[model samples]
Target: MSGRDYDHRRQMGGELIIPALAVCFTLYYFTTIWNSPWTAQVSAFSIGGILLLLCAAFFIKTALLLRSSEASLGLGGLVGIEDVRNGRLALVLATIGYVWLIEDLGFTLTTFLFIAISITALGHGKNVGRATATAAVMSLAGWAVFIWAFDTRFPRGWFETTMQGLMANG
Candidate 1:
């Protein structure tokens, strides 16, 4: 194959992939808003506007990439596609299990397990000790940010009462 043929193939692949992704996003955006129970006119308009903006942005990006000459459609540039595929599967399974375990184990336990498993699965640690420490710190940081800074309430699971007591004391 000639150089021009290879470039044409690459460009065509890029164009195809991006438009497909944009179409999927558009479909999801419509489905979500259509199914949502936003009965109030103002609420429906707000949600619809946001969804439209998201879809517009996705299509705009795809269009820009398709117009660009420098873009390549091949997956070769992205790192750890195989690892990511495996990691994603593991993440999904772990998320489901975590939801089930939350009632029995509590939020802290479930979150910690999920974070550690996810980080490790994403090819985080060559050293066991380092990985454990990193996971611990990340879990703690996430907890602090969500609970303290954002004032967001997560499912406390079995620890609900205890967390409430702590919050009251604080």
Candidate 2:
């Protein structure tokens, strides 16, 4: 294909992707709001509104980038296409795995694994030790924040019996 054709195709693809993502985000936001509990309506509304705003920002950024002269050469010109493709695949896989494991592995363990896998897959392999340590720290911090600060009851898996006994005697 000619350079011009390739450029036009790239631009068109960007244009389509941004709008599609925006539409999906809009639908998701509305669906979440609609399905939210009555008691948590205000909280859900606030979160949904924030998500919608973020999605709008992403849409605007994508549009602006696509309109720029650099987009003619495609996103490959800005960021290596191979890296972007790999990163995107990693993100998709991590998201799917997180959803699948959320019930069986529980939120804490699944989130930890998800973070580690995502970081490793997104070209962060130079410091495996550091990445693992950081993932562990971050995961524990998240667990503490959600369990203590929010008073949320995250599933404790098969260890719940022992944990409950400790809590009861303490």
Candidate 3:
């Protein structure tokens, strides 16, 4: 790569969207934590500051590359998959399905389905048993940690209610 011609523009400029969104989210997080407790402020700043630094570095690197005509802000790399069936579109649709189904299905069930579907989609429909097992494990862990331990008010569907009753009884 060092000896190769450097004039070729990179097609992955669309990848920068995530870092840009991170910057915005960190700014919003900063605003929210300003009026909170000192501990919250410290934690928020600790993480958000690191995120900002990383985003700044990425922005500078991208700027240098763009200035040198080595990268273009084109969506082709992200959105131009020739085979739409097996590419990013499937992942996007899976995410949409997850979001659409989460409320009724609850976190554990929705997450299970999301992870299973996403793994199958990404793996091109292979690994059915492993994907199902992986999804079940991940969703149960998420439920145990986030829902049970932390007791977050994530929309309570049948699983959450049943678990709540079981824990209360036992």
Highest-scoring model, TM-score: 3
Tell me the whole-model lDDT of each prediction, alpha carbons only.
Answer: 0.64, 0.66, 0.84
How many backbone overlaps does candidate 2 show? 0
RMSD of each: 7.7, 8.9, 7.6
- In model 1, which regions exceed 4 Å deviation? 2-8, 11-15, 21-81, 84-107, 144-151, 160-170
If the candidates were sorted by their lDDT against the true structure, best first, what order would they fall in? 3, 2, 1
Give a tens-digit lDDT track for model 3, residues 107-139. 999999899988987888899899999999999
After superposition, the stretches of candidate 2 with alpha carbons farther than 4 Å from their true spots are 1-10, 17-86, 148-150, 155-165
lDDT of 1: 0.64
lDDT of 2 at 92: 80
Better of 2 and 3 by lDDT: 3
| Candidate 1's TM-score | 0.43
Which runs in model 3 stand beyond 4 Å of their true positions? 1-78, 83-86
